[model samples]
Target: MTLQSVLQSLLTAFNSLGRSRKLLLIVLVIILLLYSLGPRLFGYGTYKHRYQDPNTACMAQNLIDFQSRIDNLDAFHSGDFADAVASKRMAYVGNGNIAAALGSEKGLYIRLNRALSQPINFWPVVQTRIEGSKKKSTVLDVKSGLAYKMQVLSSSSGCINVGSQLYAHRSRPALLVQDIRIQNPSTLPIVVEMDQIRDSGWEHVEIADASFTINGAETVKYKIYSSTVPLLKSDKVIAIAIASVSIESTTERVEANSIKKFHLLTAVHYTQPMLAEEAPKYLPDCIQQAKGELEKGLGINEKLLRQEHTHVWGKLWYSGFSISHSKASGAINGDRINRTLYYVLSNAQAPLHNVMSTQQDKTNIEKILYFPDNCYSGHSTLKSDTLWIEPEDESQIARVVTTWMITLEKLGCKLMVGAVKLTDPVTSVLYITSDHQHMQELKHAIHVKEINEAPAHEHHVIALHKHGHHFGGLPTIFWVSIALLIVVFHLFLFKLIYNEYCQGQERYSRSRYSL
Candidate 1:
């Protein structure tokens, strides 16, 4: 049809429409025009909101001004997780051989390793109870190697505040210490009942005794004023933990506006008995070493101990890399990076003096190299044409793979292949290394995975399907629904236009006939 004729027919059809339908048509046209040009007309709004808001604009400047104050205060602070008596938020503190996951509610779980052997688990080293106080907050200071918590008991008669610091001694790796301070800020004396009950797992325990010998062996004696709990058996004990509470009284009367102090200590010792004959000698040495550590740790002043701990951590920070960010999201990411470094370093130990310099150590270098593996592994060799797969989230896989790459580079191993495929919540990492022996050892040490000769991308898809995560990036149903909606909208618009044109043609024919 001619353009003029079509325009005339459309205009006539629109004019003949009912008032409501005409109004609807006008609204539809306006909507369509706005949809086409809205971004161009209002694009400046985003810039204005982001740059004009005082809070957002000042974030970077504020971070710069307060950067130094927060440098040594790498802490995870939480105030809301301390409501109930049993409320717990766990934070980890460790020194390579010994690690503890402590809850905000004064619960502790320990893990002990001997000569890089498998770790032994010890739960609830000592149960803690406070009669009349509620937890206020918990702060895990990674830089200082301390976990701090505050509790307050308030009543009409008096107010009492309790602050506690829990830390793994940096100087003495096996020592764990807790300091509690009670402050009474009232005219009346407040009677506080605090108890550190020994765990049920601890058998043949003694509280008041200052020392204990394990397995009837006088040589294997621990000289701590606490109970000794041996794991495995008395004769074949692989690990032992000593726990002590300094406060003799279950209830302490705090004088008006005064303070009372108490402390708890736990020491762990373990030995790797390679042969049956070595158990006796090694067990005694382990106990003696633990005793010496406790004695030395106890001799140091509390303030000095904290200073030494912080100094050690300061050295770590100085030696390691630093991350800085000015934007809010960048700041959050920086915090996460610091925490990740803290976790890895907390469980790492420095090399012994002259250990790395010796020819024997050089020959056993592979045995000395350690990598944290909490995910899957697969077997492959330097000359083998095989793929190693790891099933984990993308971020976790990235971290693990990055750690592996760094360690492997230090060992002079070439990285042949590294690839990652992300399928929403499930992610897979494929790696091909030039060191087959190292890969095989790692496979045996960590969780094992199936070796896939298929292409990396295809294997990832297969793994995801096996895990019931078939949804790729977006759901298939979602895209299908979206397409269906678009089709229906176009069909409706076409039908409306065709009906208007048909009605207009009929009227035109009738008018022509009448003429």
Candidate 2:
């Protein structure tokens, strides 16, 4: 059986085939071709058209731009999470508007007015007595037997607006005195000390006796004191105020810088320092954990970026979900499809549940999923460690589970699934490890192929398209086509073997019987 004989034999058998068998062979070839290229050429199934998840499209673009900026790459910097968080916070607080940064429609002043609980309006008149005739009485010179008097008078009260209500009062305004101190004006090294003063809530604070000696040689005695009263602006004034008092030597007065120090009570939000001892439990547990993590010089500060979330600041398994696209396969549109990514916060789980279960929720979920800038603004709720998905339909749930196993392998993350439960027909619980190694693992997972080591001009877009992706061995279409060809070739070879040997032997037996 040389090559010539084998070729002749195969040709003879093929030529001997009837027209029907040949037609069948032609039909088989046509079917194979249709199976291989039909969907790609004609557009059908998942391969009907090129798919780009609307949710991830914007994120992918921003990620490309951010990765390109070598100078401002803090967000992607390995192990520098705090700097990333700071950058995100600054971006959120655009134009120095705190309310806007906090996602409030109203301004900070409006919030402040709403936040005020106490109501009192009394503008303090400095150097004026509170008693009848509110007259100013200033002391020019003071001697051993002379008494000096300084008073701060309160003006008649009026109505003030706080939030939605107008607080009207006629009583004298209350005063909150911070400090009363004495400082030398002429000395090169300023001398300052706190003076004792008694104060009552409604009555004027008065200091009756005071004496002092400076430099151990210059003995100076002074008698007179009053509880320092805080000056309050009129109801018309929108700005809040603080009052401080300082005493200066009459002999050597420097009007410009008379007070050595001034003290006022800090605002409520800023008062209780973020220290452990004084820290309020009202702070999110994640924020507290973040503070601890920051002190340890480890992990990122998620608190600043997600102040509203309870678990905003921790490197912990906040939440996760698995989604199937079974129902979405037929629902593919320009803005949505079966295959899409969603960036959602842990706090949004309840709302997500409500939306996924109803028709109304489907429309709202689109807004949540397709966020502005694709929610990749560094403030993105997308945690690299935690995976979230949108499911297609109930039938794809098992397939989705299996697909996740492959995805997890590709991601190469050392994740421990904390919980797993079915949320609905499409959603499943999928909590995973949210440790410090997550970002590193994620970066390693995504492949940047065809990198140009030499800096190229306007090369970022091209480089990103070429480099950005996980180079999983081969495209699904190409693999499927190859599999189809193998199957078809096997069937053709089986049919050839049957005709060449089996049928030939049957004819030989019939010839022997006839002879």
Candidate 3:
């Protein structure tokens, strides 16, 4: 009964306007509602530019590694998975009991040795048998005259038990088993000594005290053997890898100091159905030991040493060396199964002038793995989060390129980053020091991989959810705006109907009074 009542009466009169006026009011309410949703619809494009660089290779590795781990409940309970087990490489409890019960061609269990996109069907491979006319038997029969074979350990990163034997879990003294492994496939009764294994790749043709002329000109000749059979000069990579094993324990103490320090790290594959059972406990304990001893990592002997993958670096650059045999092409392609050298960047104190005139141009260099502050020589299931030096501009690159062949000496992995000596590149080898000297390089590269800062994916993009919230008790902004518009339209329609009804009632009262 005051100013408010007078305004209400005026508002009712205005609401009694025509249908066109009512329609305009509804349209106005809809426009206001849409205004609330405007920002989110157009805000996406502004946050999409942080992931465009070559350093993205490291980023890609990080992304794929994470994707490999995301739980797909749909796949597991659906019964569509297969598991592969490498038994020869399983746990070893006794001194000589390291070798397991044997399987067909290779071991009691074949090496999963590479990362498969999905769980592999080992039954088919295990059941697979060679035809009588195939290579193994045929080759043996053909060489019946007076066959000699050799057994080699290509490379390994395992815990070593040095000195004597053991007692309980605490008994085995740990030591670095660089380039070490037991030989089940070795050409039975042959030794591929440690010295020969150290000088296996093309990078060190110059480092070797003695050289084997491919033409076999001299009697003091150097040799290349696979298992026991000496290889012809033209022998292939697969042949070399098959006969190689990386053994650490028995290797000379001097050589042991030359390899890189081992780090305990996490891999994406740790969550697989096969790995899930063991990885949870084994991975952490192993990583913890490695971390505790990072200052002085303790490498011990375990039958499962090879299976658990330990990290180590090359003391010297020897990419293609074999201890027991020649390498095979198949081995090179499948290096990811047992990834070796983890690439890193170094802020080497080395000067810029140290860089060569040729390396001045980034385009001219063969490849740039770690720049001034990058780490991790490269990556894989086995060697993740391992660290190394970043190359200074010129001379360092020259040094690695001029004298290197990418080797899987530890896990038989090859050429993780820069080109090995014989590796084909338009430019000469460009080196960002891929060694373990620089700690900063390793940290930065790891940070990139962990945060998934690379790639133009949803994860990398910034989400404004934290800041895009509503205010004043609003219902998620969008909902509130929609509700407000409906309220506005209903109120306008109600006023129109109420005003008409009120006028009719007043007229009826006036007529009754007149009567």
Candidate 4:
């Protein structure tokens, strides 16, 4: 058929249809048009969103590592003591140069090695005194920082005595003395005494001092002392004295041994101010602040506070970590600063104080996935000023996951973990950054099983691919289906109209003939 004739025939058949069918045809055409142009006309699709801040990812990873290290308590002492030694060495002289006052650095290292293997007492010096004959005192010149002394007294039985004392030194900053060495130049038997003040009188405290003594005419003796002393008070000092306890009477005057030529050698320790300030770099502020809060909350005295601080620090020195980014001129290391900020936030633990309370009915995943309008105020990223959530029970993985997910979701993030058994005590699930810049990172959470057990887990995750409202436009398949339906419906209507019209014309012709 010619184009014009075909068009005319189709139009005539369409006109034969009822009003309802025509309306349906118009509706289908509109639906098809709307579906095709929906994205441009309406502007809708799944919005790209962030479930967590990529910037703080490295800090979180560091915290996880630190927590893992601390969770293993048996290794705590050695790690902490080594850090303490290194920190002290750094503070005293610095990394480049070791102070001559510390005596032989080699000897110091050896003593530190011994400290690692054995229990060592460490204390800060309060005040040091060198005493001679008849209560006469030898002086340590402040400028030179050196001490010299002579024999205090010799008994009728041939025993000589000398004294060196340590009281709290008020002028200097507080410090922890890990080990001390006193060198005796003469070869003779030497006995050292440590007298600690008690309620009644001065009492002898038995100490294991590594003594290097050789019995010869001019035998040289070396004495090593170590103490893990309590935190030194600002004003108080403990007294320590060393004297010669001879096994037998020696009438022979060995000038070097008899003169009592001994040097303080070295005071091995680090200052307290540095210790307190630098603690957060290696230890979590939450744990430390929690200890301080306990002290204040319970009205703990200095003695108790000291005990608690020592106990807590000894156990966990792991803090969050920092990763360095591209060096900006004079920019503080972003990773270090973020780690510090993480600690501060972790200790704050006041999520809903001024913030809106979260709805309880929401599932843990929903709680994480949704964000309120005001939640992102003042920050480009979702603001979770108080992101820390205390795990309800360590034994149950669900509790941990739920708690962490809720916290993360509040910050506009989601987490996925493998199928985890709640009963596995050693299994741990944590979120971490893959790199320093926190990009191209895996969206999945890590499930870590204990080294000793069989691995049991399934990959489970809530994939975060986009942000904003999830629906945008109809798919290509949907559009194709609509087109097919419209074509089929229109064809059905045209056939019906054509058949009905033909039947009517025939009936009319037949009736006229019968008349």
What lDDT would each prediction earn against the true structure? 0.51, 0.28, 0.26, 0.30
Task: Name the weakest run of 10 consecutive residues (lDDT summed) in model 2.
Answer: 161-170
Cα lDDT tens digits, model 1, 1-515, are 99999999999999999755775677567666655655567673234434343322322332343345355547765444444222125455666556554452323333322112233333323333446534455566777777766555554544456667777666566777778788876688777666555444554433334643333453222223233334333343443435343456668788887988765566666554344444455555555666666655666667887787777776677766554442322123345556556655665663331112465755565454553432223222211211122212212322343343333332232332343743222223454667776665443222223434435657446435444354444544457556655765776687678778987899989999994
* Model 3 lDDT tens row, 1-515: 89999999978976997765766676776766567555557563245446543322322332342232223210001010112133211111111101111122212111111111111111111111111211110000000010111111222332111111111111111222222222222122222223322223222121112222223442121122111111123231111101111224333332331322211111011121332223334443433332332122123223443222211111112243332211322222222211122100111111121222244554434244334322324334222322222222222222222112121222122323443332111211334555763323323232123422234524212222222322322335567568777877797777678777987789888999994
Task: Provide the lDDT at 386 for model 4.
Answer: 23
> Model 3 Cα displacement at 51 (Å)?
6.5
Per-residue lDDT tens digits for candidate 2, residues 260-374, read 3222111111111133333334333423332232222112122221222212112112343433322222322211211122111111123332211466766687686665433
Q: Best candidate, TM-score-wise?
A: 1
Comparing candidate 1 with candidate 3, which one achieves the higher TM-score?
A: 1
By lDDT, who's the top model here? 1
Candidates' TM-scores? 0.51, 0.23, 0.21, 0.18
lDDT of 1: 0.51
* Candidates ranked by TM-score: 1, 2, 3, 4
All models, RMSD in angstroms: 13.1, 28.9, 24.3, 29.5
